[model samples]
Target: MKSHRNLVVAATAAALAAGLLVGTAGTGNASSDRVDSAPSSIKTVSSGWSIPWGLSWLPDGSALITERDSFKVFKLTQSGTKTQVGTVPNVVTTSGEGGLLGIAVSPNWNTDHYVYLMHTASEGNRIARMTFDGSSLSGYTTLVSGIKKNKYHNGGRLKFGPDGYLYATAGDAQTSDLAQDKNALNGKILRMTTDGKPAPGNPFGTLVYSYGHRNPQGLTWDSAGRLWEAELGNSTYDELNLIEPGKNYGWPTCEGSCSTSGMTNPKRQWSTGEASPSGVTYADGALYMAALKGERLWRIPVDGTSAGTPKAYYVSEYGRQRTVETVPGKNTLWLSTTNADNNGGEPDGADKVFQVELK
Candidate 1:
């Protein structure tokens, strides 16, 4: 049976009417030198969708997102309208936890208009690239194939790092033991070229950048070019790890704490009850994590490569937060929801996109 542990107990009609809600996380001491500013404002953009996953902003201030179970990619404009851009192919939609997942534009997208996607395919899970004209997609190409898939452990987050290469997250397909196998792509962070070949200068000499991940779903970099990932643990801990090439992260072996030697420890971790960190991003010297099971937005300050205490926002605020992306010009965070899941509360058209302003 799938875990149904993170649902909210009650709901407010006003909060639902306003199209907003919140999640919660534990607090800790400040490890980073800089402190996070208080949250200034939180505003909802839209809701009434199924499981909304990946998010990417367009140049025109519009945004594109994948509706997992629906197998469609939506374009959301500044004025708060949603239009179906294209149907994502090969998505094997599963209730609550799986379907069309992550989306990202080409690093050179202005010229190529290429967008990439990670989804659970008919055979299993796969990554593909597609091109989008102003109105719709023109072509599609598979980038990676033959990945195993299951309902709950599909780690399908994709991002292009500052270096212009794509980094992908893969889950162990519920086989926890696969996380420790360096030769396998499952349960690992992979660095690859746009064509899906192992990236140059990778420490492992294989597609694996780091191994021993449970279900990594978040990837982002700071202004200083450090890579961070958010991972979901089985039933114990959820983690935020600072990634290093070729290092092991002790999944299935260690859930929280730096318990294993020769493995990189998480900069921060929370119990499964506290956080099921999904998507993460760095902006204004802090890392923002979107929690699914935990249902809150967490801001962790970063000093160099280390993390500080985390501040929670929207705890029981919304229902279940899915992804958080940073908006460049405004210096605010854009948060999206995951209300269609079984454990999620008030399942009627409640998923939303929210803008959080840092004071």
Candidate 2:
């Protein structure tokens, strides 16, 4: 089994170098212009980079962006100055979507100064924590390992929930059955302590928070503390689900809306051709979703318990939007591009990090 997995990873890396595939990567400013009402007012803050991925704010008023292909993390200042922080640990870069992926800061960052990451480690994709000692990384620990691995479906989104616990999304690794297995860690939203242990009051005794997810690339919380996830469907019916503790998302069994007796239904579903939702962020009392295949930014208005209709901007505008993150203390969002994926468009510089102003 180890040998087979190694061969698969090797092939994936080779394909990546050959430019046969691209990975997820985006961000920008918060604007007063209603993005849904005036789509044309969406402005770019910055751009020009190799593929970029997850994003997070730093203590020095800067931001960190992940470049999956190069296995590097960049610190970007307010003026758009970019500096290489350091390469993430134990990432075996591969094609069609595998590399150093999601990144997040400790919720209590002032005391811990730890940065958490979800990457494709040797034993498979895993979640780990590392403390940033101002200049470099130290005190590394593997919080969780032994996740399923494959070319695609390696879900790696991470965020700190309002409840002071860490929430992460994991793909099924192309093994559809794993999504429904309560004991398995794949295809689920996992909640853990800052030390990587399962938090108390978890629906399951283990790390499983919610199950039956297809490929959840994004997770965010509304002002009401409601959890929302952006998931990628197999061939159709992408979803925005109201995530509940221990609830099933009806993955391989159900695509768009929920029909299963025990699973939760999606609040909104879009065709694959419209939105391959990746990163999700809530700012100014709204949720912003970054699209890859749909090549647009979706501004979905949210009330306490319900979400309004999705208002899309930039349909085929920037090519392939990957991640959307809110830069705190500012009214802007950072958006990235993924034009190197198996389905991404050609052109050497198509992969870039961009800033979009929100209204």
Candidate 3:
């Protein structure tokens, strides 16, 4: 993003300490100012870049943002300054939905000095660990691997739960029938330890936390710790599902919802044209979803487990939204547009990141 290409040089120590302090990306300074509201205004924080896919905050309030094709990560400050922290190794693009995907800073970062990344590798999609000493990245080690990969359907979003376990999304990898195979890792939500082993209390005693997914690209937890997933459908619909451990979500059996007895229906479903959704976040008692093909942002209010009607914002104003993240400690959001590659057909370096003001 052009706004991200900094003119003012930054100190290494101060720049590296930008984000992280547990419980979320925001800090205590603005903790009391926290409000849950829908985005009312938007500002361009960074401009003119490739597909900026993943975003994570550092402990000191600065954030780390990733580009899909470049396989690079930039550290962005709240005031609009950015610095290149370092590039990840062993990342390969599928020329479709692969490359550097999701990133998460350890909740125990102060003592661990660890950061995690999910990316497309030579063999398949893998989750890897690297040491980020507050400045640069080093020491790459594969924590989880052997996930089947395809040009599309490579679900790659990562987050840490309140229970201190890592959770990830794995798509069906174009093998739709395999989504029903609990013996496989593809098409499931995986819960694991930092070392890549299956977390304790997982369903089926495997990494699979929940199964029967197609191309689930988005995940977020609500106030009650309920996991919400956004999945891309085959032809008819996309889904917003409230995930439960060991529950069967009908994939090949049904696209949106069906009368299948053992299948769990979604909380909400959208037409594929309206929502090729990705990167969901909880804000203001609602879920702010980034729509890729819909080219808009969706604000769906939530009361307990009930999802209210969704209101569309900035419809067609920003083209092809990819990621929307809460700017910790505030009732605002940071959204990115991916108008550069894949179906967008725009020039390679024509993307942007925005700061959305919430009510």
Write down the TM-score of every candidate: 0.90, 0.86, 0.89
lDDT of 3 by residue, 127-196 (tens): 9999888888889999999999999999999888888999999999899987999999899999999999
Q: Which parts of model 3 are misplaced by more than 4 Å?
A: 1-36
N/CA/C clash count, model 1 = 11
RMSD in Å for all candidates? 5.0, 9.6, 10.1
How well is each residue in 74-98 modelled by candidate 2, as lDDT tens digits? 8887777777878887888657688
Judging by lDDT, tell me the better candidate of 1 and 2. 1
Residue-level lDDT of model 1, residues 195-295, one tens digit each, is 98999989878888999999999999988999999999888778888898988998888876654677777878877766788999988888899888777
Question: Evaluated with TM-score, which candidate comes out highest?
Answer: 1
Model 2 Cα shift for residue 144 (angstroms): 0.6
lDDT of 3: 0.82
Q: What is the C-alpha lDDT of each candidate?
A: 0.81, 0.78, 0.82
